[model samples]
Target: MDYDSVRTVDTAVADALIGERERQEETLAMIASENHVSEAVLEAQGSVLTNKYAEGYPGERYYAGCAYADEIEQLAIDRATELWGAEHVNVQPHSGTQANQAVYHAMLDPGDKILSLELTHGGHLSHGHPANFTGQMYTVEQYEVDPETGRIDYDGLAELAESFGPDIIVSGYSAYPRAVDWERIQAAADAVDAYHLADIAHITGLVAAGVHPSPVGIADFVTGSTHKTIRAGRGGIVMCDAEYADEIDQAVFPGGQGGPLMHNVAGKAVGFKEALTPEFEAYAQAVVDNAETLGETLVDHGLSLVSGGTDTHLVLVDLRDSHPDLSGGDAEDALTEAGIILNGNTVPGETRSPFDPSGIRAGTAGLTTRGFDGAAMEEVGDLIYRVVDNHDDEAVIEEVGERVLELCADHPLYAE
Candidate 1:
């Protein structure tokens, strides 16, 4: 679609929005958990559904005049089930964190024991960060990746599960590079009779495309974000066995949130329909291929990759060896100056704080969606190396930025 030509009626906001669109067209966006949705998704998100106040599920809605809203929501639910093969689907959670919270509210009590990945190691704060509601409400026992291999130690996790005997076992990550062994995780949870939840926020599209293994059939509950690789709107979804449908719905509505965002749900319906297309499957595979190629290029540039490499759309660069004196924050700023956008992430067992970690997280979803391939990724890796090597050279940074703009122009994100 010609996103550049899509005019906004409000002139004051239009200029700023156009500039932002131009910026996206001129930079390399490698943020691991971000992606560009299609114009169809955006159209659905900005539709008249936003004016409605559908405070409940289809047929049981609290507001009147929900006939059309019910149809849209039902279609969304059907598409979600067909796309992921889930027995039941909840399309109402505002975010992935809310989805997780809904599961906790439905299945666990306050002070219940929970086993999740350590945030610094790869898990998200919503899983069990000390300051988050999860940590305050539940006793969180965290597992970490093996320092030697930079991968999850399943045996170690099993041992911890046996010892901790958590009430819930959460399997997912925000930065871990390798594929998770869902069966092993399920067994670990089963050994202790704990409820198992899989948060595939980052890899949901990969799963739908069969590039990554699906956790739906094995996990008791599965939660994910619609944006990341799904290339949808900004929202979350929860899927589970049909028997738990009532509990999950109640938790999301009365327990955590109130009225649902019908507009985003409409966008999700369009996104889910797009995901079921053959083009999306190819796009998903390309994202993984681009990530692996980028990781290899980074290694060729003398950087160590966490988990040795990626099996999905993201690669975590362990900068300890390449730039012993550089912090993740410094690398972030240096790369931003060169027109490359990504986030600084903490590697496993890194002593540095989250704000200044030992690693950087980059991904292929956005770039691939922008039409970049393996060749573009190799050049991107070189740009990254140059920026890090010439951290203090403004002229060099400007030159690299121009090159990035040239690349973006060659492969426009949205046609005009």
Candidate 2:
């Protein structure tokens, strides 16, 4: 993985690149939205297609030299179609946020009402947070998970929808660990004649492998990140019925972005190809199994898990009950120092600031990609607890760091 060409041109940049690779190899990646793409996917993303300007969809590019770009983009669309069974798939949004942006651009007028989950209750900013364009452009209303159970209250959401009469309802989440009820959400949207956009950015691969219930057929529009559980590198996709295909295409191009990132499209093609295999199905299942084990291990150590447990590849630990004085940010810092990388996240009914919330979110998608099993994840859970329990103890952190190095060595990632 040496950046020899980069080193020849700029040694400083090369050093940083090599350092990042080392960093991934040394630590555990438990951030719910992060994952490692395969080397083949990496090669495709770093290819010469990056130089091409494919501003339009296949067979209709504004640029002249787009024959190969068309082929790659079409391949990505085809593979994504097979993976999710969508009538239309747009692989051009630069990120998941942009994917959501395209849907909004295609369907909603300015000040159109949006009903979505609250950001602190496991929802994403693109859903309706004030900082994002969706919030500014739309009339945003938010719902929440039941504070007592840490799960979405579908009945409550239905009441909110009936009262608000929103134009769209956004499902799917960033930190929520339980499976989403797309049908329930869709019903609510249907009652109000509202559109439903399910942002499956965190569980794209799980849905693709049938490990999680897919929202493709149920929701009016579905969007996801290519690099999370899917391992398709950095990009976003929008999927919907053929009826809305042209609107989505236009929205993603002239409406939001200019030229497509053809190299990332190539990466999507290759990674989606990889995901269509039996092995990938097994990996997706293992990811969930590992997460369950991790959650159980953490519970055994007296930590609190949101919703009691998880049925997906991530777990949310609310530190409020276990360590009332310790903030999630402090736990995150200690875990990082101990070579286990995860993020501090907000839980339902959060009382603290977003920067230093009450929960830490961990996922097994990256670890499972590196061939980690339930046993390995259980040990990882133990290691995490050690740091959380003794965050300020220098000796404990040093010991946990050494154990993390051992685990990293045992399950090496991106090995040459």
Number of the top lDDT candidate: 2
CA-lDDT, candidates in order: 0.91, 0.95
Q: Write the per-residue lDDT of candidate 1 for residues 310-360, one digit (tens) a residue.
A: 999999988888898888899999899889999899998897889999989
Q: How well does candidate 2 score on lDDT at residue 14?
A: 99
Scored by lDDT, model 2 comes in at 0.95
lDDT of 2 by residue, 1-416 (tens): 89999999999999999999999999999998899999999999999998899888899988798989998898999999999999999999999999999999999999999999999999999999999998889999999999889899999999999999999999999989999999999999999999999999999999999999999989999999999999996899999999999999999999999998999999999999999999999999999999999999999999999999999999999999999999999999999999999999999889899999999999999999999988888999999999999999999999999999999999999876
Candidate with best TM-score: 2
Worst lDDT 10-window in candidate 2: 407-416
* RMSD in order of candidates: 2.0, 0.7
How many clashing residue pairs are found in candidate 2? 0
Q: After superposition, how far is residue 144 of candidate 2 from its true place, in Å?
A: 0.5
